[model samples]
Target: MTTADDFRALHERPEPFLLPNPWDAGTARLLAHLGFPALATTSLGVANVVGRTRATRAEILANVREIAEATPLPVNADLENGFADDPAEAAQMIAEAADAGAVGASIEDHTGDRATPIYEFGLAVDRVRAAVETARQRSVVLTARCENLWLGVNDLSDTIKRLQAFEEAGADVLYAPGLRTLEEIRAVVSSVGKPVNVVMGFADPSITLEQLAEAGVRRISIGAALSRLALKSFVDGAREMLAGRFGFVGELPPITELQQAFD
Candidate 1:
């Protein structure tokens, strides 16, 4: 089966699957070796590594290409805002990402400006429609996202409204990244017929995989959570080194395991 077909089927399965986000080729391969069926690129994780608040389009696509090439697992590119305000420009990112070997992709309704965090309703829906057209041509599973909760707007009503519009616009999967509670997730899931994706980082840690699947979540992703945890470990170790302590080195395991994953 094609990668797109494989990825689309994962969302159709009875139980929810975890889609881990990797920032680079190495991490992508590592996650694949660890047995994930699919992988996603984390935009913020890339920004952190590149030393920018957000990496440029060229940088993001290069990273996508690298990760897609690194593993056999289906890859979902996080084409943030499609890197443009114009609908056509936004949709072009999907074509490039497909060319980069991504079987799936996401376009969020977030405007880069803090003052007006979301695109106006009409424009947002239009952009998603344009993207859906291109995604269909490319055979990519297009995920349309509502940024209200992700940006701290705390409006479930608006989130559901936008996702429904995107579902009507032909988005294969619907996502709202910052939902904090299962109640909100259930509300969104019940309002739409398409599969719903929830970011685990935004939800309560106590919530188990069974609970999410039972609540009608078909896909579960941890956006930048693992990458952030890796960074935390690095920072903590670096601090220990700065304090003239050599004890952290003693905690290291043999490099064989990581090397085996690379092999």
Candidate 2:
């Protein structure tokens, strides 16, 4: 098995790669079969699958282990907020995630609020530093995410400042989820010397893989977009059937293919 050290070494390349996030073992294996170099666990997808409002500390670690065992490709855990209220507990959670065979993990600085929510810049940097220190014994890569985009803080300069601090704090990758502008993307890449991970979910994934590479992003992840697409298919199929319309059924993937894939 390739260790996390091996994965970390690959991130130094100038050209970036996409690290698509998958929800389950089957999805992970299929992506590996399709030639993706690595896969990340989607927190929203797993949390929805387990029927939990949000994935708990135990749930996230357990999911990482299960998915890691299912494939040989490197797995990066989307460990939401490190599953802790404080820096100490957050560090412990990062250690546990690394032990579960994760090559990398992401910690976001958002508090799930619409107004006045995110952690102060200093505190957020401390959390990333603590997480990196905890994973020092392991070879896990730590990504520090600033949710200023989602929080409606549209200033790219502020985002760059936060990412710069995270880089100084030992974060291997810096991510800003909702920044779709080329200017902002370029600014972030220039602000942090480490690799950058961008989420490609909006209608038009604004930046292409080539454009992102030129802008200096090292990784791209489609967070929950695939799962949502799958769910939309199910809902559309059901609605068609309820309306006595069988025409849309053929648009779905062949049942045999799904069955054989699982087999």
Candidate 3:
């Protein structure tokens, strides 16, 4: 089966599968070595790759290629907002992402403007529909994300409404990333017929994978959580260096263990 086919099938199971995001090829290989079934590119993580606040199309797709080629596992590209305000641009971005080796990708509704963070409802759904057409041709599993809940818009009803429209637009998966409670998550799941992907990075750590699955989540992703964790460790270790100490060394895995994991 194709990578896209494999990726789509992963959403069929009862339990929610963890879709970990890797920042680059090394992290991608490590994740594959650690036995993750799939990997994804994080837009913020990719920015860390080029030492920029946000990455350009060329940079994003180059990172996508590197991560996808690092391991045999399918890679989902986080093509945030499809990189443009126009629906055509979003469609083009999906096509380009597939060519770069992503079998699955996401298109969020966040406009780049802070003054108007979310796209108008009509334009948002139209963008999704445009992306769906391209995804259909490439057999990429497209997850339509509503940024309202994640972006401080505390309106669940509108979020559900947007996701429902996205589902009807032929998106394979639906996501509203900032849900905090199980009730909110379940309500989103119950609102749509397509598979729902939840980002555990935004939820309480106390919430287990089982609880999310029980709440009817199909796919659970850690968007930039792993990247942020790696950053924290680096910062903590750097502080130790400034303090003239080697104590943090004991916290890391043995070199041999890391070598074997890479091998």
Best by lDDT: 1
Give the Å error, residue 129, model 1: 0.4
Q: Local distance difference test, per candidate?
A: 0.93, 0.82, 0.90
Per-residue C-alpha lDDT of model 2 across residues 200-228, encoded as one tens digit per residue: 87414656888888888888889888988
- Residue 106 of model 3 has an lDDT of 91
TM-score on alpha carbons, each prediction: 0.98, 0.92, 0.97
Full ranking by lDDT? 1, 3, 2
Deviation of model 3 at 247, angstroms: 0.4
Report the lDDT tens digits of candidate 1 across residue range 1-263. Answer: 88899999999999999999999988998899889999999888898897776888888898889999999999999999998999999999999999999999999999988999999999999999999999999999999999998788988899999999999999999999888788888999999999999998888888889889899999999988988998898999999999999787998867887898898
The runs of at least 3 residues in candidate 2 whose Cα sits more than 4 Å from the true structure, single-residue gaps closed, are 51-53, 113-115, 202-204, 254-263
lDDT of 3 by residue, 1-263 (tens): 98878898899987788899999888988888888899989988988756777888888888899999989999999999987899988889999999999999899999988999999999999999999999999889999999998789999999999999999999999999898889999999998999999998898778998898888899989888898899889999999999999899888878887687577
Worst 10 residues of 3 by lDDT: 254-263
